[model samples]
Target: MTLRADAAGRERDRERTLAWLRGVSGELASATIKRLEETLPWYGEMPPGRRSAVGMVAQAGISSFISWFEDPRATPWVAADVFGAAPRELLRSVSLQQTLQLIRVVVEVVEDRAKDGDDVLQEAILMYSREVAFASADVYARAAEARGLWDARLEALVVDSILSGEYDDELPSRIAALGWHGHGEVAVLVGTAPRQLEVDTLRRTARHMDADVLIGVQGSRLVVVIGRATPRDDTPDGEEPVSFMTIATALEPSFGEGHLVLGNEVPGVVDASTSAKAALAGFAVARAWRGAPRPALADDLLPERAFAGDPLARTALVQRIYTPLKDSSTELLQTLWCYLDTGRSLEATARELFVHPNTVRYRLRRVADIIGWDATHARDALIVQSALIIGAMSESAATRRRPTRR
Candidate 1:
């Protein structure tokens, strides 16, 4: 049963080979030459092994064509060498003379089939063209790789150029040559993930922010470049200043066992390299936080507010957190402040403000209604109070506003 099955499979293979040979013949006259002509450049450039393969195809095709044209009976088993596979092995079960005779019969049968129909001997000439098509596809894939390599080299050069301070060259064109665009604002974003979630989440967040990002692995570190990073304005009292602490606080929970450092906002290529260096410094801060862990974040590394929580926190309190009520309706805000100062006693708040306890209650409720949250809740109230203090003080510094208190 096994021998019969093997014989049937061989017959099928031979038939398929003949069918391909017939199709190839049809393409020879005009089509085959035109197709191969396009690949000549690439073919000539291919390595010796592949070039030899093409030559072998051409030789076998010539021998087969000659044998078919003259006396098929004189053709040797060596004719199979063109398409590869040893002719002797292919004709192993039969003698060379018997193989020659079989070829004569097969050639006569094919010719008779073509005489009244289409001549397929033309396919032999088309052989290498088909092989060339497959080879050319590979060349195109390699060309894509070359483009990627070119881009990587160009990026390295751009980094060196920037480091050397020739600030006006067309770096974007160099990047684009490697088939990438440095769109929007170019800035550096650095992330340190001691946990796996930190790196992945940061990547997703950067993408959500519509950044052009590139990530690289350096030993145990993951380095990332994010483009178009607008400076985060964290001051909420309508001040134009930036607060790195707020940035850290906002990003900390999502950091998931990693650290986040917001580098300087570098909106253009001229400043991106510098910003990248600064961000690296911020990463140093993140490393330090490993010991202290004070709700730590990288924005804590900023030059001015790096020491925000102690003496500076108390000194800046009046100007930072209280000033928001100065220009607006101070009643509800003042009552809310006094209530906190009086340790949640409405009577104490009323006594301090020379108003009824009911008036303090009404004002506190009004404050909650305006701010969209009931700040009386222990946790939420703390969050609001912190936000107000931070917003007022930080925004004040950002805008160069004179402090209302000291």
Candidate 2:
């Protein structure tokens, strides 16, 4: 009879405490919002609409706590009940840290009010606060995961558009959305893709170099479109902007074992197709050169590219080399031709031209000064020879096509 009486009194006291908590739940929510305005500066700075949304979330949290106090089985719905009260935009404008601060303020207000109540009330507040914190974290984590997947898909689409040279009006807006920091000049780098691509590491490396890249993998090939994060004019005093070739060399280790070709730098990203074409052409014919460097400039492989029937390479050789030499002076052209025909021997060249060896040597130096290719180097000799042959053939063809006077 004594044990039954004690149990009945305890149950009556619990029921009375529950009644008192329900009565003051509205007061608790009001105090929590007041405390949030005082303690959290971010809450006060929010726009009026967002501030109202936050207040709704606070009121919802207090009501959910009361429901949980009545029955512990409602623990699973505590987070949903509180957060679901706010607008969807609230999750975006309010950061996770700010949300936790709001939670802290609510718990503090509730704890201070329940101080005079039984120990069970204070323990329930603490447990409820912990659950809300975990739920907020889960909500933010899901949002971030969804955002990451969207960014990856958008990035892949941008890279595809760049490689295909298909520009729509929305391309600029899309690039801006991707947070592209590239400014003025852009270049393309082509190489073999590694067995496993470490995309994050490559991005980190590009960031360290103060550059930005758009990476794509097509079959076994990898293409990276690089741009300067900082413009040339904006570089600090006494420091020059890094050259594209130097940048390519630094990024060389990221590629698989094969030829790495760097295209000529273009004016901007919109003109990147020209550079991409050159890099792709050089990559195709890189093996034709016996001693080509691992990271070879597309311009340096003009002869090999021309042999592979790349019209751009052929035009570059003729326009950059043959035309300038032929236009400058016929003597320089003849000297270069004789020098190459005589196997690069100064004495043989001089004997064939019936001039002093010193004169032949002087003319060869002039050839290098005018056209930027030296007959003494075997590779350059081949390039100069190819240009002369193509230039002569074109001249003969033009002559044959001329109308004879009747």
- Give the winner by lDDT: 2
lDDT of each: 0.49, 0.87
lDDT of 1 by residue, 18-129 (tens): 6654565544323322333354454455556554444444444534554443433454333333335323223223333432332333334344444543333345324433
Clashing pairs in 2: none
Scored by lDDT, model 1 comes in at 0.49
lDDT of 1 at 77: 38
What are the per-residue Cα lDDT tens digits for candidate 2 across 43-86?
A: 89988899999999999988888888878795686668899878
TM-score of 2: 0.87
What C-alpha RMSD separates each model from the true structure? 15.0, 3.0
Provide TM-scores for the models.
0.39, 0.87
